[model samples]
Target chain A: MNARARLLVFALGALLLGGAYMAALSQLAPLGRGASAYADILNRVCVRERHITDVVTAVNFDYRGFDTLGEEFIMFTAVMGAVLLLRRGKDEVQAPQEDELTSRRGRRRSDAVALAGVVFTAVLLLFGSYVITHGQLTPGGGFQGGVIASTALWLVYLSGSYKVMRQVGPKPLVEAAEALGAAGYALVGLIGLFQGAAFLQNTLPPGSIGSPFSGGTVPLIDIAVGLEVSGGFVLLLLTFMEEVLEIRLH
Target chain B: MLNIFCYSIAAWVLLIGLYGVVTSRNLIHLVLCLSVMETSTYVLLTLIGYRVGGTAPVFADIPVGTKAVDPVVQALMLTDVVVEATVMALLLALAVQAHKRTGSLDPHDLRALQG
Candidate 1:
């Protein structure tokens, strides 16, 4: 359709949607109530049963473990798909002439900027680890922490070069870590099965609430997810950067 | 009411995102519009779970009787955010490949399969 016609259709759709939403909002009950039916049960039993002060983490890693498992796999599959789609083709060849072009365009880095990047990356790595490990007790969790940690790798790339990144961690090792992380999540779930509980059942002891070592298997799952996410993201970045650099892949 | 205001803002965001997506010409712009749509949904979900006087759900220093905001929606939103990131990554990757093969980023210009 033409631009005018498309705009008219979109405007009409928006009007209808907005009207429906306002009508629904008017009919809804007032907010600021106590626990919902679902939240009520969670509040009543989650702390005592799982010994986790963070109900969100408990719900994510324990109460709704299966769903979290599926979410992790979704990420794993997406990363794999990206790798497969972005793979270097057999017909493509890298020439040394591109290096000259890149070098000519490359700008000199300042010493201060490089130093700041290194310092910030170290701090980010530390903070990310703290976030992942403290997930059971705090607001941040595996996914958030993992993404933060992955930024450190990006910082290294930004401050230096692709060659520096490769020296920091080889492709095979990073890829292996990603696979291991995904597999480790499943392995943790299988442990519950072997212990006579259903899949992903938190059979380990739910230690004291509000402690670092509490939450039974929740922390373990968080660590596994953290590993998987960090590895997957770093690998994704590495692959994309390689493509940009026209690096050969065999 | 404050709740109504929050909901209306979210609705506006959603509508704006929809409008952007419908009118977007470049593939990159379309992906960004999609992200805006996702953000609207996140805002709606978080606002729906908000309690006027509720504290954070953590029990670290709060009294047992203190009311807390809904944790279920927060957990769901967390998952949604991660999914959004990965989805955007894959979409951008596809856009890159399309640019490589078609030599164009505009949807109207990509007619390789029209025949």
Candidate 2:
């Protein structure tokens, strides 16, 4: 169908869908008044039970850890698919990747900008590590910190070059780290199984509340997730970058 | 009345995203429209989990018995976000393949699937 006709059709269907959606919305509790009894109990108990100051992390990495395992694999598989799809075919050459703009224009990069980028890269790396480690105590965790840390790779690329980014995050090393991260999570859960408890059960010392090591395996899982997520994203960035640079060679 | 306004905003954003998806010509634009649609869920989920006088569910600095919003939905929101990102990446990869094979990003140009 043509664009105009398709939009017209969409409008008619949307009206009905919107009506049904609004009806469903009306049934949900009002904003700021949702009395979720289960969450209330969970929030109240996570501190005493799991020593997790961040109740959300407790839910993600503890109470609902099994689901999180499945979630992690979904990401791993999807990223793997992306890598497969974006890989260079047999016909593609093994030439070095260079910035077409800089090479063609022959312009020099600014020293000040390069220095600032490097500084920012270091700062981001530090902050990301802090976030990942303090997941059980603070609002940030693996998912958030991992993405932030992965940004460091691009910062290095911007300041120096793509080759430097690749050097900073070597492909085989990153891929192995991603695999290890994925495996680490499962292995961490196996600690419980080996102890005759359920899989992913929190069996370690809960430690004193409010401390960094208080949440036992929760923080451990967060570190593994941090590794996997950052490694996966860096791999994605590398794949796309390679594709872009290779295409420019033509 | 105020409650209706917040939920209405979420609903409207969802509709807009859906509209964008149907009208999108390019595959990348369609992928972005999907992201926009996923954003509406974040809004709706946060709204559903909010409490009138409650704070974040953390107890790091605060004492026990303090009122807090639902952490369950927030945890689920993280799941939602991860799923959305991975799906978007997969879709973009598909878009790259489609462009390479068909030499066109426009969905309308390629109506029939040969493979």
Candidate 3:
């Protein structure tokens, strides 16, 4: 058999083996469809007593909040690492002349592309704000919204040049926002401790459930986390793009 | 019905991502493929939590709600999206830097530190 066919056959065999392994594991499950107590809890309890919204938010900011905190830290670390590793070395910065890299050749975008970019960036900014603000009430929340907001800058980058990206993404501004966002995230956890609850406890009033401000510390945490993430990702991407572009100063 | 659609789409997204990873020659494309792969997991998790035609899991909708999706999955996916973006950003940056020094987008040519 030819190399390609051999590879395909090997892959198919592996997939079948994996499926069999998973099926075997499935047989090990308890012989019940659902938990008896959980079903009882679902059926016997009144809706208010069940308190689904509060339960969710509580779990979010409390039970698994440490995981959320760690996620924010991961973003922070990734961005910082990117900046440190790809930053222009002093030698590269001082080099007399560097060869220009190949990218897109002479393809200048039409004005319509530029206009669409501007419109899309605006829509992303507004949508991100909406997502963050209405996080408690909707599926989209702070982190998702924040990434969306930050990626809007890439739209700007694609529209114009590195200069436009740099103008909006100065190192100091992004760094400060990132730092503040982290501090804010930590403070949310601390608030629970201050209120005699465990760390990252959902201590704040849950408020009226459907209100924009109902999720208590969750919304605040979401916004803080969003800001930090957006700032971080933008910095990381731009730093890399600039390195690739290998801009040389006169 | 929506759940089945969600599941099918999730599978499709994952397959498309795998295809990208397998076929891509450019470093940027590989990084983007990884992002797409991560996104498929997001879709799968979110769909698993979804109740068909369910309202948002808030008090306003809870009164008339038949079932609610899992908020934990939503929160988890939200965090994952941020993490993915950050990681993708870093990967793209590294790819750019590698290109600058060695001058190529193809991964096969990036053997700069080989001793």
How many clashing residue pairs appear in each of the predictions shown? Answer: 0, 0, 0
Q: Write the per-residue lDDT of candidate 3 for residues A57-107, one digit (tens) a residue.
A: 334444577888988888888888778878666556523122222213367
Q: Score chain B of candidate 3 by TM-score.
A: 0.81
Give the worst 10-residue stretch by lDDT in candidate 1 chain A: A95-104
The parts of candidate 2 lying over 4 Å away from their true place are A97-108, A247-250
Report the lDDT tens digits of candidate 2 across residue range A55-137.
98899999999999989999899889999998876656645545552332356668997999999999999999999889999
For this target, which candidate reaches the highest TM-score against the unseen true structure?
Answer: 2
Q: lDDT winner among the candidates?
A: 2
Q: Which stretches of candidate 3 lie over 4 Å from their true place?
A: A1-13, A20-59, A94-124, A155-165, A246-250, B1-25, B50-59, B62-65, B101-115
Higher-lDDT candidate of 1 and 2: 2
User: Which run of 10 residues does model 2 chain A get worst, by summed lDDT?
Assistant: A96-105
**Residue lDDT tens for model 1, A1-250:** 7899999998899899989978886664565643477875775567777888888888899999899889889999888888877777775655434553233245776778779889999999999998998888878878899899989988887676666776776789888888887888788899899999999999999888788889988899888888888998998998787677764433
Provide per-model DockQ scores: 0.64, 0.82, 0.32
Task: Pick the DockQ winner.
Answer: 2
Interface RMSD over true interface Cα atoms for each candidate: 1.8, 1.1, 5.9
